[model samples]
Target: MSEIIKIDSIDNNGRGVARRDGKAIFVDGAILNETVEANIYQKKDSFEVATATRIIKESSARVTPRCPNYGVCGGCSMQHIDPSTQVAVKQRTLEDNLWHIGKVEKAKVLPPIHGPYWGYRYRARLSVRYVRKKNDVLVGFREKKGRFVVEMDTCPVLAKRVSDLIPSLRACLNNLSCREDIPQIEVAVGEETVVLALRHMVPLSDEDTQKLLDFAKKHDIVWWTQSKGLDTLKPLLTNSSDSHKLYYDIPQFGLRMFYEPSDFTQVNPFINRTLIHRALNLLEIESSDRVADLFCGLGNFTLPLATMAKEVMGFEGSETLTERAMQGAKIHGLENKVSFTTLNLFDVDKEWLENLGFFDKMLLDPPRDGAFAVCKALTEMNPSLRPKRIVYVSCNPSTLARDVDVLVNSGSYKLLSAGVINMFPHTAHVESIAAFDLVC
Candidate 1:
């Protein structure tokens, strides 16, 4: 049975929200403020999930999706909406989260930061499978709401080089004896080179290695084989110097960062640069200021802060990342100005926070979980130990909202400004930055 419902808004996952019998129905492929004919697929206690069978009335913000696989591919959800309006939706989502979840109003809304909508994903993990029934190898992201991979010849979201190689990759994998053994491919793009790490459950034969080398030479793709874990990854084609390392540069700060393929780096390099610039501007750093960067991965923000401030302390829970950050600092000749420390910010308390010494400012770039423990510690610290200004970069808005609530309600801080960064355009993921000022 088909039912018509008016989409009231969109959810965090980009699904449209509609009310039916006092229950919230999440409809796939429906735009906000538009009426859709949907067929319910799954029913839950409080809400039901449906797929829009037909668009009875379309939204003014709706636009034709560029990718043919947009509806089925799990890579993107908001591609159907206009690129500019997509950022608007994300901004509204962030504001709504702050007001509803944090129970506080933002003193100022910073303009959204955005970049290209296509070919912006420099990092991606694609699923691979040899389908005997289809007599071909499928390589791409998974289908929407399915375990099977979406068979795509190209991905518009990926860099043109990576996207253009999808078919060739499938052909190469199909010819390999260990095709069935390969389960995943990690794509990491740098300014000068692209690396593809193939995860194989079984070891590749000598003949397979030669075939990979040939493919590498032919397509100019750096091939890496991972038999077990990330640590086991090695270049299939020896003497591939480009595959030995990957790095990006912050030209504004004259800094370069090198990282291993498996390390965590932002998928969008343009947004990352802009994000760093915005964060530094908001921190109001001075030459005499001593800044701490919590959860700093690979010295993304720490290195830049070190260049601007007298001394910067970078703390991360992962010892591997801390070591990498230190190396980056040394490479940039900022080792004396910046220090990397292995500390678990998640488990921080008043004693640990106070022991870390004083800082004039802080930059926190935590994972989706947010820095609740650290924020709580900040609230409990003596006024003298607290940093005057804090800039937080969050990947998840709900967690950010929750943490900001604690910061404002308990930490004696005021929410100065907040805004969204379109880090992953055409997706519902919102990367945001917020500034907080300590109350005197």
Candidate 2:
């Protein structure tokens, strides 16, 4: 049945939420304060999922999406919503998660951090599919709610240079002798370089290599071929030169950190720099203060912390990342002040926390799974050993909420402030940061 419902607010997944017979109904492609005609497809005892058939009333926050494949492509969901309103919705989602799931109240809500709505994604893993029937190569993200690749001519969310290279990349791959063997491309854009790491199931022939070389020379990109795994990725058309190097700099801290194309780096460099600045500010690091950056990938936060603190120690699960972090420290002339160690943060226990010693401040930037183990370990530690302040940068709200609950309720910490960061604009991915202080 077609039901007309008023969208009261947006859910965390960028779906419009309404109520039908006291049960919450989620409608896709609807906006807040708008009345949408939706067809309920999946009905549960407590809620229903629907797709909006038509909009009887449109919201003022609705805007025309720039990408033609907005709804069809699974890369972005909130493209139809205005940038400011998108951030607002994300902030609300963060707040709701903290309150409802974490059972913690923040004294203040930090204003959402946002940047360019388009062309902000610096890194992306794109799928490659050679459609036999279509006699064409498909290179882009997956189709909405399906495993099929979305045949995209351009992707505006990627760096403009990379976005413009999609059609040419598709053509180059299609022309390759082993086109069917190529399955994926990892696009990484640095401050001064662009790298495309192509994953191949079979060895490239001499002709395929030459084609890749020609494409690299034509487009001015460094190509890497991965035969098996990330460790197998090697330079295709370029040597170990400045042109092939991938690095981003923090002029404010006089630091430039380098990493391999497969290393974990923030998708949005603009928001990343801002997040580092905000984290440092919240840390209030003194010249004599020692800081610990857990789950620190390639010293994204450690090197900057070292700039103001006496000593900074970064710990990560991957030894490769730790090695890169140490190299970053050395390049920035912080080798003596910053140290990197390999530790499985997800498997952290109270004994491990005790062995790490004390720090004046701590910063943790974990993946979408969050840092539940470390928080639990912190809760078990003595009050005096706990860091004075803790800043957590999280990519998932649900996991962030669960970890925050452990910190505030059980770890004897107070949630001073928390807010959302729009790292992936036009998408439902919620990147957020929170500050916690030891309860007196």
Candidate 3:
């Protein structure tokens, strides 16, 4: 039976929310204020999952998805709505997470940091599958609800140069000697360089190497082959005259950042640049202030902070990343102004934090798990040792809410301002930043 339901709101995952029989019903593809005939597919104790069979009422914000494979491919969601409305949904998700999860009543909502929505994805791990039944090779993201690779000719979310190469990439792999042995491709795009790291289970035959070289020459893109692990990733033509490096440029800071293709970097370079600028502006670092950048991956934020602060210390869990961060600082002529250290940020306590000396300001760019230990330490440490202000960059809202709760409810801290960043515009990924000021 087709049950009619009205969407009360939208969730961060772009799902429509409604109430039925005293339980929350999350309807996929349904938007706010729209009534739809939904089918409940999965049931939980308090909530249920559904899909819209038909729209009794449609929202004006609905727009045709730009990508032909939008619904089938898992690369993007929310393409059914206008790009402007997509960001609005993200902002609402951030605020909702703060209130419902953190239990804080209100906060100053900062203007969202957003940029070019289309062709914005600069880095992606695409899946490769050789289907024996179909006698065809597929390349791109996986299916929305299955592990099978989606059939796609081009991807709109990738940089134009990278998107245009999907068909060619598939064709090249299909004719390879060990076509079935290849399982994945890592794509990285810099300001002027494009690196495609092909993960193959077997060694490439000489003919396969020549084919890859020809493909690289024809496309002006470099190739890296991996046999077992990321450690095995290396350029196909290491000694060739081609001397390009994979790096992105931040003209705002006059910094050219370099990284390995397998290293973690923001997928959307435009929004990343905007996010860094907005984060630093919100940090309000002064010349005399000593700042610490927590989870500083390759000095993306530390070097920029060094340019403004008297001294900056960056801490990361990976020695490789810390070494790269130090090199970046040295090459940028900010070695004297900044330093990088390797430490397990997750295991830190109040005393450990206190041992690091006083930091006038602090910035955190943690992974999806959020900075639990650091926030807890701030609440437990001497108020004199706590930084006066903090600016946190988070990719997950639930963890951010959980950590924010620890800081505001237990810690002597005031939630000053918080807002969302449209880092992944079409998808439900919420990249947000929050500010806190220690209570005097």
Question: What is the C-alpha local distance difference test score of each model?
Answer: 0.91, 0.90, 0.90
Q: Which tens-of-lDDT digit does each residue in 105-218 have in candidate 3?
A: 698999888789889989999999998888779999999889999988899889999999999988998989898999899999988888999999998999999999999999
User: The CA-based lDDT of model 3 is what?
Assistant: 0.90
Q: Write the per-residue lDDT of candidate 1 for residues 232-266, one digit (tens) a residue.
A: 98777667676656889999999889987788999
Model 2 lDDT-worst window of ten: 236-245
lDDT of 1 at 355: 89
Q: List the residue pairs that clash in candidate 2.
A: none
Best candidate (score: TM-score) = 1
State each model's C-alpha RMSD to the native: 1.3, 1.5, 1.5
For every model shown, what is its TM-score relative to the native structure? Answer: 0.97, 0.97, 0.96
**Measured by TM-score, how close is model 3 to the native structure?**
0.96
Reference-based lDDT, residue 291, model 3: 98
The collision pairs in model 3 are none
Quote model 1's TM-score.
Answer: 0.97
